[model samples]
Target: MIDALVNGLVILMDPFRMLMLFAGVAIGITVGILPGLGGLMGMALVLPFLFGMDSYAGIAMLIGIAAAVPSADTFPSVLMGIPGSSGSQATIMDGYPLARKGQAARALSASFMASLIGGLIGAVALTALIPFARPLVLAFGSPELFMLTILGLSMVGVLSGSRPILGIIGAVAGLTLGMVGGAPVAPEYRFVFGELYLYDGFSLVILALGLFAIPEIIDLMAKGGSIAQRGPGLGGGWMEGVRDTLRNKWLVVRHSLFGVIIGAIPGMGSSIIDWLNYGYVVQTSKDRSQFGKGDIRGVIAPEAANNSREGGVLMPTLLFGVPGSSAMALFLGALLIFGIQPGPALLRDDLDLVFVIIWSLAIANVMGTVICLALSRPIARLTFVPFYFIAPVVLCIVILGAFQETRHWGDLVALLGFGLVGWLMKRIEMPRPPLLIGFILSGLAERYLWMSYNLYDWDWVYRPLVITIGALCIGLVIGGIWLKRRSAGSAATASDNDGQERLADNRAGEEAQKGAQS
Candidate 1:
């Protein structure tokens, strides 16, 4: 393993791979700084370029882009309260609040540091797991995969905010939306309405844009204000944010690890990473009450998880030929075009390609951070842009991007349709992220559950790993319930106290009235 790593390191030392890595990171940061674009789009754009390139250089570009995306995406979330990608949406909940408090630089600093840590963790994991990667990949069968998706569902509780019921409803809605095409086991169509476009299933990109991007556009329009009035601070407050991350090192590590583990399983990606990390931070913090209220840790958790998941996701991709997320799957397809097969044999035959991936990721993270740091001021200035202009442009991007996935007019229709639904859901205080989460996991969970059942005839249910994972899922559900109850009790107690104070004031007023009458 050491020898292979050394050989891989030598391949990464070449100037061409390094340049591609730098370019990829730069492009990823640019994409991430945009309000609607994400690493997925960046990867898609670069996919064609990889068609006939050397395996190492091609993989370098993709790995670099993936590694840097989270670093840049956080800038918008922290500066303008807008998410550059769904992964950074979780950052907006806390990072933007901090920006409103004149701590945009600080928030960016924290976000960058956390992203760096996450990138390192993911890269190391990807590199180290290469030896036994094939077995680890194959060991995850239908039951384990289903359990993993269930774990992702645990994030719904966190997305629900103060309303768990609405969260659940949102989740169910997501599941229904996910089931728009054909059934997993059987070959029958369910909700196509006889449209040819629906036969291939609704595009994940289209749904993502509608569910995540549209809601932000509406909120930005409704608010009629930018996130902050001031431009980025030239002061060294960004360094203070870095200091804050160091202060909470353990939290960053935990969240990054959470992202890696969840991301290692195919079908669970950035959306789950953000919400899962958010939920974990809220549940375990010493001052749990401070979450969602401009807490730096809140920003750090999602930022770390969002970045780290990139690496964790690459594990299954390079090792097992199982793409961890949609972008990675695309990367794998690009590899196949180049006659490069992914898996254990690739490791032995083309260790150089493996090194290129690892080093490219490391180098990309550094380059992305530098680019973000340089552009922080200009990007932060967007907060002063008029809300009206920002609205139409963002809306157009959302619409166009959504339609790009399938090139069908119905997808455009669905985009507008889901936009309205998303807006109404927000009006009623629904947690939209969980609904998306539920939708993403629903297909995977249903498919795996049925496959496991048919294959094992219930014997798989008793497998120790499967049982343990199920128990953990049960515990997460119960834990969510317990937390909700506790929160309700606290709220009730606060209400009772306020009521008693009002009663006392009324009695005092009555006494004064009686004295005046006498």
Candidate 2:
């Protein structure tokens, strides 16, 4: 195994392979910076070019693209409140707020640093776990997977913050939208209303762009100022952001591992990994006030998780020929195109190739981070540019992105409809993250629930993993409630103390004035 590892490293070091890797990283970053163009698109564009390329170099280039995307996508999410892709959606919660506070440099740097560390950790974990992961992967049956989806939905409560009812309503709305298309188990559609577009359901790109991007654009244009409302300069330096990530080292490690575990699940895509991590951090923290208002920890958690999950998703794709997520599905196809069979025999015959992938992922992360850091100074300047100047370009890009979903007119209509809904929700101060989370998980939950029933009927509920996950879900709810109440109590006590102190100060001022008059 060590010899194969060394040989793989040696192969990756070849000049042409390194150049291809760099080229892939550049393409990945470019696509990631553009809203709605993710690693999947980049992968599709590069697929045909790999027809007769060296197998090692081709795969290296693909790995480089995958590794760079999660890090690069943070640019749009932080600077403009636009989700560069689904993976960076959670980052916008805190990151964009920080940008508005003139801390764009800080937010961008911290996210890049976390991505670098998380990518390295994921590579190490993948290297260590691949040999022993087969049994663990097989342990999660349909019942257990169903429970996991429920676990993800439970986060809606924590994400909703002070408005639990609104959160629940939003989640229901999202579930309804998710059910609009053809049923997984049944032959009929649920809410199409005879519209052919409804048969395919809403694209995630359109939903996300409409919900978050359009609302922000409208608000910015209406307000008529720069994205950084506070000032013309970045209030904090890049080193400060680096320090923030270092200060939250444990958070980076914890969520990166969480991302790895979630990514290993076949149907659990990148869409919900960051949300789960964000909700978990909020639930566990003692002080929950600064989260959506630009806490650096929020930036660290999701950025770390999104980058690390790339390595985890590869576990199933390589070991079982089961693609863990959509991007991995493309990767699996690429492997087949290269005439390299995945699964057990591939491991036995081509272990060296596996190590090459690990090497490429780790190195690409480093290259991506350094490049982002170098670009942060200039890119961060976007926040200081007036919204009027930036709005037209952003609006055009967003429209283009939404249209690409299906190249159908329905995409634009949905975009406008959801954009209005999102604007209303924002005006009302309703939480939007829960709705996105619910929509992403709804289809998976339905599929898994039916599968469990078909396989074991009522008996599946008694499975140990199912019971364990259910208990964990219950615990999360109770714990979130407890933490929220404690935070409220503390705030009340602090307010009372301040009131008493002000009263005493007023009395002292009166006594002093009376003495002077006398």
Best by TM-score: 1
* Tens digit of per-residue lDDT, candidate 2, span 1-518: 78988998999999999999999898788767755557865665576567789999999998989999999889888877777787887788788779888898899899999999999988998899866854554567778767766765665675566787898788788777888889978998888899999998766657766777778778868977554433334466799999999999999999999888877654354656776777777778999777777888988998999999998888866775545565665576578668886655467688899999999999999999998898766654543556688678768877876776678999899999989998899899897756665665677678889999999988999998889878977886676666545545543443454356558779999999999999
Clashes of each: 0, 0
Error of 2 at 284 (Å): 0.8
TM-score of each: 0.62, 0.59
The reply for model 1, stretches above 4 Å from the true place, is 1-118, 125-137, 225-227, 236-361, 476-518
RMSD of 2: 9.2
Candidate 2: stretches off by over 4 Å:
134-235, 378-518
Q: Enumerate residue pairs that collide in model 2.
A: none
- Cα lDDT tens digits for candidate 1, 1-518: 67767877788777887777787887787667766557766765565455456777777887888888788888767766667777876687678667767888888888888889888888888877776654564566677766666665654664465676787777788778778888877988989999898887765555555655676667767777554455445345878999999999999898888888878765454765676677677678788554555788989988988888988878766775545665675566557556776655566577777766777787777777777777777765654566667679656666666655666898788888877887777678786666655665666678888999999988887888788877876775566556545544543443454356558779999999999999
Alpha carbon lDDT at 242, candidate 2? 96
Report the poorest 10 consecutive residues by lDDT, candidate 1: 489-498
lDDT of 2 at 157: 70
